[model samples]
Target: MWLYSEIRTLGDIPRHYSRITPAAPALIGADGPVSWSQLDIRSNQIANVVAAADVVPGARVALLGKNSTRYFEILFGVNKIGVALLPLNWRLALPELVAILQDASPDLFFADREYADVAEKAIASSGLRCRVIGYDSTRPGRSALDELMSAASSDDQVVDVNPWHTAILMYTSGTTGKPKGVQLSHQSYLYLRLCEHLEPSFSYTSEDVMLTVMPLFHAMGVGLSLQALYNGAAVAVYSMPDPGKLLALIQHDRPTLLPLIPTVIQMMLDHPDAATADLSSVRVVVYAGSPIGLSPLKRALQAMTCDFIQFYGATETCAGVTFLRPDQHRRGIKLESCGSPLPLVELKVADSDGNEVPDGQVGEFLLRSPSLTTGYHNQPDFTAHAFRDGWYHTGDAGYRDADGFFYIVDRVKDMIITGGENVYSTEVEQALQQISGVQLCAAIGLPDAKWGERVVAVVVPEPNAVLVAEQLIAQCRELIAGYKVPKEIVFVSSLPITASGKVMKSVLRDEIIAQTSR
Candidate 1:
């Protein structure tokens, strides 16, 4: 058996797996299943081509594409030559893409055929000088990825890649301000895999098939895929998240593991075909990125006969710090808790003065782990503030129970202060979720004359469900204190969510402010 400690760099994964399980399926996509031997050889060919380009060691190579098999090939290839891979989020606007390109300043830019125009616009806008190649395009001046791979040698080259060498430059989701690049090293990802090995809930075998629906740009997507590969399990890539398509794939491919966000989970359960879908092959379903409501969770448990695992963390922590295990779900204990920290991770809830708080008291959550990123890419001052006192401040308000389980309340910045009372938006949102007609809701503070701020709830009702503001407020008051109930309610068709499936609370706040002013 191969141990986690023996793995040094990302390149070692394919090399080791191919030797032991060369004929086994490594990746399954729309095209078909690719064997481990093919994965190793193709990645080597891409690495040789990249090495022959004469780029300096540690150079940034940016990739703009949706989820696909070629993405993984480029990922390993970039790491094989000691260069950092920056997976650009194609969902961002052109200006956002340009800003990131300007900051990364990659030595080479690779884009999929569908995103070539956007890549050209971003490069032209940012004034970045780099060789642009299309992953599957054969345009006039653009070199096709297939041609490059075919021409390069398949033999692996010896490169000096250390554990501390930076492997990825992932950009944080810019909800408040401009996104900052986070520098993650090979050691960080290796440590994360080690942590996963310690937890029984995350156990994987070569026989397991993982269905991946999250975007490759997000940390969750990358971590899940890497975990599958690390364990020598086969992975199936779904380009995007669609409830109907996901169900169809599950029925056809019969993947044993499916990792998704809460939003997608709810959509899958609500799909009309979900009742009759043959999801018996699924053994474990993992969800993360945001808190899931109790109502939706219960419904999902009834619908799908699979163990549910919930993870909690940010991009800085490599997408997981704590996991609510399946055993806890089976026992129905601490349903609201995000659960205990991983084996090698330390968690603390600290006050604004950086002092530890008592259990059951909400405070800012801070974590220390080997899997954490070194710091933000370029902003030294921001990095200093974030990594104070040898802990990465998560900026999330949460508390620990007497049983040692952690519960996330809300973001520190998302707290609502109204009439000298403090209100956590997550708490209010949880209360609102209990209402029968409400499908989704976000709580925010709006400007008020009498009170310092008024709590406002933006809701998206369930289909064919009529909801009145007064009735919803009455229901919320029954569950929580009157002060915590929403003073005003606004109904919308849908909430603005990020590609990773997190609600954009700042955008909602701005829209509410504009509506009140009018």
Candidate 2:
């Protein structure tokens, strides 16, 4: 009922910026940047291209690409006209991608030229209208990204959609199974952004330069980019994630704020250049998407003198409904916890029968927030299951301490029930990451006959790293409960990880099943 319609689109940013700080750099593409007026003008051009294509308001337009400035422009354009933007996963196989496309049934599909072949096959298989454009479109029919800015209108406003109307329908990365489209309303989007806005540290002042390494499709990226631009913060976007390049960008831009995945942070800590990197200007480093192991968490602290705040949330809940501030993390409390609730969010831990658990008991995490997704697209039954009794069941099992700090045990679906005892995968994975030879590790519950499910760890060793399962088990036995340790360790060259850098344990479970069966 309030006026968050004010932050509804890219157009909102220009007027806000012009009034607050006109010359502030609003967007920094890999090539360079544009002022607030330029970003809005650029989005307007993309909107014209969308209009010329005969796309009607309320039409569904699909975008298949990585993190690019053009992609954000397209997002603004499509949403400005009250059309829903669907961004397909670039990593999905063509067959699976085709299935998703069939579901959305988009009016027009734009394939990033980098993924031209895959996108072509995906669109071709689907019976949807489509075209291919170079991410850096220079040729005719290529529909260069710049063309949208030049060939189209510089319109200021389009008909606004209802706050309850859908904007972007982002599908889950589907690490476990088929991706489901998460339906985010314009208001819910604003609510999530407002949670961050509530923070006393937030500012649109010209002094704040934001460095973003997360993908544009991610909830964190979408939330940060829009709100930051609206507030007039200059944002430098990395089209693709690279440990070295990200550090260099931070050094060059001297970003005042950075919200990123733990893996990116760990990589930055590991980079040799970080020792000499010009990070004197960093004030806050917001880390999330996945929990950090204790070792990497410690290293990340030592690597940067910036205040670190770790947030935990999901696409379903916009972003951080809970945050562990730097002060709490440094005070030797909530080390494995994701922190307490944000201003507008509510959290509860519930059991199998949908009963809320005691404060100290581990159970599924559930949420009821103004920012939670409206529902999964076209999946009423799934939505009913997800949004139960006004609470969105997180499918994650965690407990709250007497002081109300939350601790994540593991995903309820990922818990191993070996010998009738529940085991949290993160507990073992954390222990495994500490072993000298272990470079990377993932723990998953594999189907088993003796035990309903057994804990299995897939590990990638460091160069010249060597370790036997027995040695690792002996090490784990001393540190954690025996039931919590992996029953077997399978050495892998690498892990299947999502763009946000969380280890895809569900993928690992499949490998574990095939190997165990044989």
Candidate 3:
């Protein structure tokens, strides 16, 4: 745990590892294993490149890519010069990406080869004059990141980066239909690791290998990967989540730590190779991002025969608030609970009036932690609304039992978490309204076996207007990300409305479920 105590900032992680365990494997990807020394040297070169470009402290740099060695290098390099790294979600559509770029206004942009075209288009549309740096593949107008790093100095670049400075600027779907950038500081990550060190449950060892399949844009992917690297463990990075390739990687790399969602868990278990795949190397399987059904939890436990830990939190909290330890994951033993607050976390369930609720009563979850984000970038109004009286107001509804175990019942904000992605119903409903044929529409999440919840649009067609489900779905696809698109469209004559003329999504969701079951 010397490394945990020594690292004061995110930039120090690579520097400490380079000296203590230079020859140890830090990352394992398709390009092969990269040692701690190599990682440190490469990150230094990256820092020198950005510094030479005259980017100053508190400036923003962006990376639009998947999970790769380049992503980590960019993350550390950007942090080295006291600049924040804004990781863009690759799955977002062009307009969505354009809006984010315009809002953030990063000084430089790094794009993976696969997203070169879209990245260029977003910059042009946003009218930003930032330089486009390419990785993996190069375009005619862009400079390759590898070539720049190769020619830059390997000497560590020192900048006055404080623990309060923003390290990562992550965007989450907003209720107002625009994404809000969550500003996470160096302490947001380092303090979480320190808390883990103090408590010592589900700890990582130097010999462990982490299988990282989640997207780098997410808090879970970045948080877990940094955790492994901080402990001198190796991370096996996959480009994306593919059940077949994941099964093969488990056999080859024999990763000791695995983190995933319920959807991926079911996919891997249903794969043809899962029955014969060797998953013995996995010591602990951690799941979060969304609620997992009791049935699927039991099925996964029976199939993998490894320790399972479920933690609950969001991007705003740096993703580690409560944890269901492996020892507590048994039948009739708080399986439905998301477990207790972490060592450094303070949690309370509050009602709408901001009053604390009694035990076993559902209310909004409010938490205070060192890992909590300072605020949303450039959105002071939003920050003021969510953070009050030294506590971050989580719009999630949950309850704590007499034994201190917390159970999440629902999301008070009406945010639909499908396949680990947060999809705001209001955002989808706004898109639906753009279509002429949609007179009235409400988006709600329904329980699904594959995805934790499937987005469903219950719509009332315009009078005498001809509309088809397939056509509406196609139109909706152009307005939002594919993941936010509703999987099914139900045409109803009328939608139940409240006295205030607001669509009652709860009643609609219940009705849809009853109709579907029939």
Q: Assess every candidate by TM-score.
A: 0.80, 0.77, 0.97
Q: Please give the lDDT score for candidate 1.
A: 0.83
lDDT tens digits, residue span 1-518, model 1? 23565568888888888999999999888878879999999889888878877766789999998888888888898888898999998766676678789888998888999998988888999998877778752232245877888889999886879878778899863324356899988889888887877776777899999998788888889888888888888999868657888899999889998998776787777789888899999999988865676777777877888898888877788768798899888888888889899888999999998899999999999999989998888788889989989999888899999998999876775766554344668767877898898899998887664454689999999999999999999888765557678999999998889999988988888887887779
Better of 2 and 3 by TM-score: 3
Kindly list the per-residue Cα lDDT of model 2 for residues 1-518, writing each as its tens digit.
12264566434555456445656677776667767666667767777777777887767788877776666667777777777888776655565578788877787777677777777777788877766544542232345655655777787556666667777887763323345788877778677667766755444455677787677767778776665665567887766456788778887777888887765676676778878888878888887765567777777777777788877778787667888877876675677789888777888888888898999988999888888889988788888988978889888889999888898877765655454343557667777887899999888877554344678888999999788999998887755556667888899898989999988777777776787679
Model 2, position 194: C-alpha lDDT score? 75
Look at candidate 1 and tell me the lDDT of residue 452.
49
Whole-model Cα lDDT of every candidate shown, in order? 0.83, 0.72, 0.88
- What's each prediction's clash count? 0, 1, 0
Residue 116, candidate 3: Cα error in Å is: 0.3
Least well predicted 10-residue stretch by lDDT in candidate 1: 135-144
Shift of residue 90 alpha carbon in model 1, Å: 0.4
Top candidate on TM-score is 3
Report model 1's TM-score to 2 decimal places.
Answer: 0.80
Ranking by TM-score: 3, 1, 2
Candidate ranking under lDDT, highest first, comes to 3, 1, 2
Identify the superior model by lDDT, candidate 1 or candidate 3.
3
Report the candidate with higher lDDT, 1 versus 2.
Answer: 1
Cand. 3 TM to true fold: 0.97
